[model samples]
Target: MGKMKNGLTGGFSGKVGTLVGSSVKGQNILRNAPKKSSKNPTAGQLSHRQKFTLVSSFLRPLNGLIKRHFGSAQKLKSKVNLALAYHLKEAVNQVEDGFVVNLSKVVISKGILQTIFVDTVAIVNKELTLTWSANLVFGSVNKTDVLTVVIYQKATESMFILEQVAERGAGECKVQLPASFEDTGYGIWIFLTDVGLVECSTSVFLGEF
Candidate 1:
């Protein structure tokens, strides 16, 4: 049942007869309702579903990070949706019969703020240290920008995200590995965000750890 709001002339939400009424970008939209059928999915359709599942499952854990930092949300697309669309198209590789996400090609954040350059990444004992300098081909970044680190363990699909770990000008930060993270490879990425400016920089893929 479609309820009338903003007067009878206003937009509505729900189904009436064979037509469905909805709102998009504050605009009232009416379209033919989908017909429910018991048809079996074709091979191509199934393949597409499999691909979507693969990407969605991998990125779901980073929903909070991506939804707030990926990019500006469009009329009908949220930032999380934008991220999914990007990885689905750019980061996936077609395997024998399914798809797998390319970890190196994965991007967690993207925006206008220029990020600091990471000079070196080294591991001492169980502490992972990340160091950077004021050297950028583009230009220097804001010293007040907060740093964010994302560590992904492919073997267990476990992730560690550290936000506001240090200031851009701080030069370095350390992350102590958890015992469960032992004997595993890490895909690490970093980005900087200017809290006052409400802007974030593209994440730097710092190779495997």
Candidate 2:
């Protein structure tokens, strides 16, 4: 209604009833708070939202694994969500050619496959045992590659990881499930990591054993 100096008294410089005005660096600035859009989202927006929902559904179950192996729960979740979204976006075109890919089978890193190919999952003495085919070419370059096994219990939201240096002839390993996780169902994910990226297998469920 009236121009007033903005001082400790909290006075305004211009009309304050409907639209407010303020001065910045001696320039008068007038604005109103923006309102949310009311229009329906475009088809592209809907598709993007669908993809995110699908990816998040797959990842939500892995929260325990992310927190346990990757650390910084919140940070890992955001990183995985973004990375998976990009991966799916790029793979959508490939799917048209019948090259359907499972998100769980995709690894975040690009690298030569080095880990043993898991053949079967078995239970031994209250533990999950994984058997694999050897990859002799894994470290022929003499680059250090690490083998990691991750067991995730979707039902109980529990996860465990076993890490070992990739050896030329090793073929089997076991992961002891925590006693607290007894009688809980689990999903197994194995990875082969070199100095660069990690390549992992799609999770396999071994019902409570």
Candidate 3:
């Protein structure tokens, strides 16, 4: 019985040794596996320094674009302001000539007539007057003709004759308010037919009395 037990133990040891040898060989095969070459770096694999330069170069155009847009916006605003100022000045000048006393004063000569038109709606109860002067031009042959001044106001479909003055060479005319005519815009049309054909027109706001 002891001999049989020893025989059995030795047989088990032999089988275990064979299995260990096979495992060792398999491990060695795995260790000596073929080495795979790494693929070449793609364009996406940029260095940190290169990446920073690329980002900066891309942002340069973006920065320039923003600046250009800002400049264009400022220039457009300037042009709009200029146009607005021009129209505002013209409107102010027109209204100022009728409402303001200092700015209303003007000179008219023989060859030229200055006509200021005021809307009656703006001067209904206001005491408004028109005054102008004319000078004669010297000529060798023709006699100095008197300058004729006519003030007319148009309302709806009809034109009301406010005042007319005819004098030799130089003259002045003035109209008292409240205007007897309807509250329609007044148009001062000055005509110099005596010396030469000259006409001028000015506009004013008219107020209701």
Number of the top-ranking candidate, with lDDT as the measure = 1
What's the candidate order when arranged by decreasing lDDT?
1, 2, 3
Relative to the unseen true structure, what is the C-alpha lDDT of residue 111 in candidate 3, on a scale of 0 to 100?
A: 29
Q: Candidate 1 residues 25-89, lDDT tens each?
A: 67889999998779999998888798899889999988998987897888888888889999988
List where candidate 1 sits over 4 angstroms from the true fold. 1-32, 123-126, 135-140, 178-180
Candidate 2 or 1, higher lDDT: 1
What lDDT is obtained when candidate 2 is compared to the true structure?
0.52
Task: Score each candidate by Cα lDDT.
Answer: 0.84, 0.52, 0.31
Q: Model 3: per-residue lDDT, tens digit, 68-167?
A: 2112223334322332332333322223223211112211221223333322212335334434334434342122332233223434322333323433
> Could you give candidate 2's per-residue lDDT for residues 1-209 as a string of tens digits?
74767564654566665666776545566676355699999977787776666555555645444423331224324445544655566534334523333534433332344445567778666676676666566434333445666565556555565555344256666667667665555556555554443333223333233
> What lDDT does model 3 reach?
0.31
Which lDDT value does model 1 have at 80? 87
The alpha-carbon deviation from the true structure for residue 21 of candidate 1, after best TM-score superposition, in angstroms, is 5.6
Q: After superposing candidate 2, which stretches have Cα over 4 Å from the reference?
A: 1-35, 40-54, 57-82, 86-109, 135-144, 165-168, 182-185, 195-209
After best superposition, candidate 1 residue 9: deviation in angstroms?
6.7
Error of 3 at 119 (Å): 18
TM-score for every candidate vs. truth? Answer: 0.81, 0.47, 0.24
TM-score, model 3 to reference = 0.24
